[model samples]
Target: MIRGDDGIRAFFAGLARDWRGWRGVRKWDTIEHDLAIKARHTGRKIRLNFTLRPGSDRDYWIVTLEMVIPPDESLDRLARDIGELFGDL
Candidate 1:
């Protein structure tokens, strides 16, 4: 399981890099695009739930991510980055 804010950022950064590479392929239409990440914050923690389906006939790839946030840390930048990432899609 991914832990901490850095892990979360790295995960999304890697995903975005790979996604950009995939977009360059001519057969990109064949790639599965059904991906969703729902983030919920409760108290000092955040839970990120991810659902991805590789194909219409395939089962979903589900993941639950929980991160502990230090009181001094702010999530505004992370939220913006996530919004921009999804906006690109």
Candidate 2:
């Protein structure tokens, strides 16, 4: 699991680099200390979120990957891919 503030920053930075290469556009929303983006990959609209949570002793983060399943795409496969993509963080 990711621990500490530096790890959190590094994680987001890496995500930015990867998504930027994929033509993702970042957006600022009402949420605090979070990152949101909208992008298209393989012609699919994707939403990515990195949310930060503060705890008693430390801060933590949650990563989410979302996309609409195309008629030709298997929901199970897409779900697994989304899980694996953000699960590491």
Candidate 3:
């Protein structure tokens, strides 16, 4: 599990890096068009928003990732990549 400010920053940075490589076509209905509109834009960077909340038990954390995806990016592919990154959790 990630701890400290540096780790959190690194995690977000990694997500940003991965965002650039997201390509290919997805069904129009599956694409989150509203997310792109809500994305935080600062200079040339498009930042995705997320929240980390405490879980019911002390041993866990709930991470909610809000993505800003292009129309062409596949939701299924993104889900697969996330699964690979976080394993079965």
Candidate 4:
């Protein structure tokens, strides 16, 4: 299990506009996963790996949550929000 949730939250708390990458993140922040690239990016603006879905053409600006396992958990507020976003995805 990850340590203090605060750290994770803090890690991804103050992210500006996010970009949709190989993974479809729900948080719209950032989620890194090089191994699960092709298997996840399905051009749906959302993915099962917990990230913002990608589109055939970049029309919408998606803010990626970045990582399901936040690096910094100190920001509980952000963490909770990120988790909810994942739930929505």
Candidate 5:
């Protein structure tokens, strides 16, 4: 879904804006090609990491967003979120 630098920037911007109400949104950027966002889910308190990395091809980028769900979060809910984010992965 993410095409190039513009898409990456826009994605990070949206995450920053959307997660403002969470505890904190921390991000680290590489010189020209990578970005990492660390934040917790608002109500679930699940730790999430969103990373944007360059793709194998030129001018392409890939995004990986993962969550660390604790035992407190029900298996059903965790499964649902995972399914929504990464289908059949």
Candidate 6:
């Protein structure tokens, strides 16, 4: 969850429902990952991913917000890794 940006939550909620995102019903841990994402649509769909690294509260969070595309190869991997790990909990 990125702070100071309600837009991210408002956007991703459009693509999928709140419950699904909240539950994070998919399993990405079959691979190695650690991330939490809340995505939504503006003029375009945006997925905000946060990777909170350990041993450094100063650099704890990293956010990646990408515009939606038909072939979003880069975003997919980023999202996947993040989802498998953090996932809003």
lDDT scores for all predictions? 0.41, 0.41, 0.39, 0.34, 0.50, 0.38
Worst 10 residues of 6 by lDDT: 23-32
Higher-ranked by TM-score: 5 or 6:
5
lDDT of 3 by residue, 1-89 (tens): 33223233334344445555433222111022221112343433444555444433534655556566542245335545644564533
- The clash number for model 6 is 7
* lDDT at position 36, candidate 5: 58
Worst 10 residues of 5 by lDDT: 1-10
The residue ranges of model 3 lying beyond 4 angstroms of the native Cα positions read 1-49, 55-66
Model 5 lDDT per residue over 1-89, tens place: 32234333443344434443444654544445465556565654446686777634535767778876543534345444534554423
Tens-place lDDT per residue, model 6, 1-89, is 33343333333333344322332322211112333443443333333433433324536665544444322444455445545444554
- Writing each residue's lDDT as its tens digit, candidate 4 over 10-47 gives 33333312223344333322333211211123343322
* Per-residue lDDT of model 1, residues 4-45, tens digit only: 232434444443333322221111111244444544444444
Q: TM-score of every model?
A: 0.39, 0.26, 0.25, 0.22, 0.34, 0.25
Choose the strongest candidate by lDDT. Answer: 5
**lDDT per residue, candidate 2, 40-68, as tens digits?**
43444334443334433334555556644
| lDDT, candidate 1, at 79 | 45
Off by over 4 Å in 6: 1-34, 55-67, 70-89
Better of 1 and 2 by TM-score: 1
**Which residue pairs collide in model 2, if any?**
none
